[model samples]
Target: MAGAQTYESTRARVEQYFDRTATRTWERLTSDAPVSGIRATVRAGRDRMRDLMLAQLPQDLTGARILDAGCGTGALAVALAARGADVVAIDISPALIDIARRRQPEGLPGRIEFRAGDMLTPELGHFDHAMAMDSMIYYGAADIAGCLGRLAPRLAESFVFTLAPRTPLLMAMWRVGQVFPRADRSPTMVPHSVKGIARAMRRAEVQGNLRQIERVNSGFYISSALEFRP
Candidate 1:
């Protein structure tokens, strides 16, 4: 039941956080760490989510128009362009958009356009597919539904996004973490359960399916990807 102001405030905070840590996030997304430890495990989990999303995309993206909603540092945008999909990448953080534009690969068959703005309100053209990796974690269920309601109409095929899983154990851990003082806690990291995701998707009038991806300690489900179609 968060109001528009609440959602906007949350997004503003997230934008600021990402603006400050854009470079750090870029490194994490493209790092080459040792392949057998905590860092490796974490990287593998992230890669799995990205790979799962990429797998859902059409193999032949020639002349396709793809929307990279909430495209953090343009990693996925660049990947889509490499596959011959014209990509329009949007993010709330100007710094992240700047980095994305700077890091854009040269001589790709498809073009990439980076924009700094809210995904829900951007006046972009229609697209064949949309992907919002790891970015919708900032919004509440209601806000997510609102975003989908706005975005679904502009897509010709489907939309894919990731959300932090809201299991009981994970919620308890989150509460415990909030009880303590932490400098690195993101104010916008709102996790949603699978049921919550479904409800939001339903509210947005989209058919949604989820696949659990990252599980930690074999107990807490860390995240999942949701694919939606009209």
Candidate 2:
């Protein structure tokens, strides 16, 4: 379980990063305020990506059991529940989990079970669908395969998640980002190429399609969504 331990360490670091900037991150995600700067625009783009991912879900979620893997701040969980899908949301960050629980909406057609834990290991029950948004960026190729391998069996339908693109242009940009590091950046964030992700999915015995998401002011495509059937 060396890989698991590595992932745990990665999660711990990510937790620390989010905990320190939870307030600002939450505002960036939930607010529509007119903010200036490239960071603000990137945040808005991420929000739009979330909307696009949600739209990819099944039109009818009534009575569906959904796994909101790495459910940061519970935005997607709330949206899913609002659409009548019972959601089991898990995250490694305690502060973000607390924020999600505290800010949970009042009424919804479906219920949400918020838990603070690693997505790599959760005592999850059967789910109709599972989604991991931008959370998978913290994992490398092998870890991604490991996660998908475990999660595939628990899912009856499909799995949807995002991954950082490994294109040459983006790789170069990622390298450039290293020179001017931001306080909010997570050290564990590793970009995977499209081929690498597809290989991981294959190793996990999942078949899926991928589409490159448009990058805003960023040099490369932000991330691509992988929609797979187990």
Candidate 3:
């Protein structure tokens, strides 16, 4: 797992990117407004990814407690709540959280508690199952495992999350992103291999093995989901 300094630095950059730089773009992308073809593909990909995560959980979550970690704009949170799962929807960007709150419907079958903060926070309490979606795609493998280590103790059954898969094209894009001026750059999406993640998790007491993996590829968006279970 990443040392505190390295993990924190990456986290700060992510906060800046989501909270300021890409806030408007994200807001628009998550909306129904027409977007460019590339963004449309990204939207479709995200939808597929969300459905993929939901498929891993119980269909009737009547009494289940779930943490929609990095619940950007709250789509996943809303869906979970609609299925009767009490959901804690968290994100680092307060602006996004505001948007998510505004988008939430009245009288959902299950309640949603929206908070803007790190998803790995202990104070958020424990859950039956947790999902981080595309949230950890920007961190290094070890840092991702550090996040998993922290959240693992809070989970009773499973934690499903996504990582940018290591691929030739993604590696090339990562290289290109490193050349941009820091102020002008978005947080880099660090691609990772499953084997690399397993190795990193070995350093932490995650106490789980990856039980499932799925990939979604839609034009500009590509992500891989892994379910970690104790």
- Which candidate gets the maximum lDDT versus the true structure? 3
TM-score of each: 0.83, 0.83, 0.96
List model 2 lDDT by residue over 98-133, tens digit each: 888988988898999999887756467789999888
Off by over 4 Å in 2: 21-23, 176-185, 201-221
- RMSD of candidate 3 to the true fold? 1.3
Q: What are the lDDT scores of the predictions, listed in order?
A: 0.75, 0.75, 0.89
Total clashing pairs for each candidate: 0, 0, 0
Clashing pairs in 1: none
Off by over 4 Å in 3: none
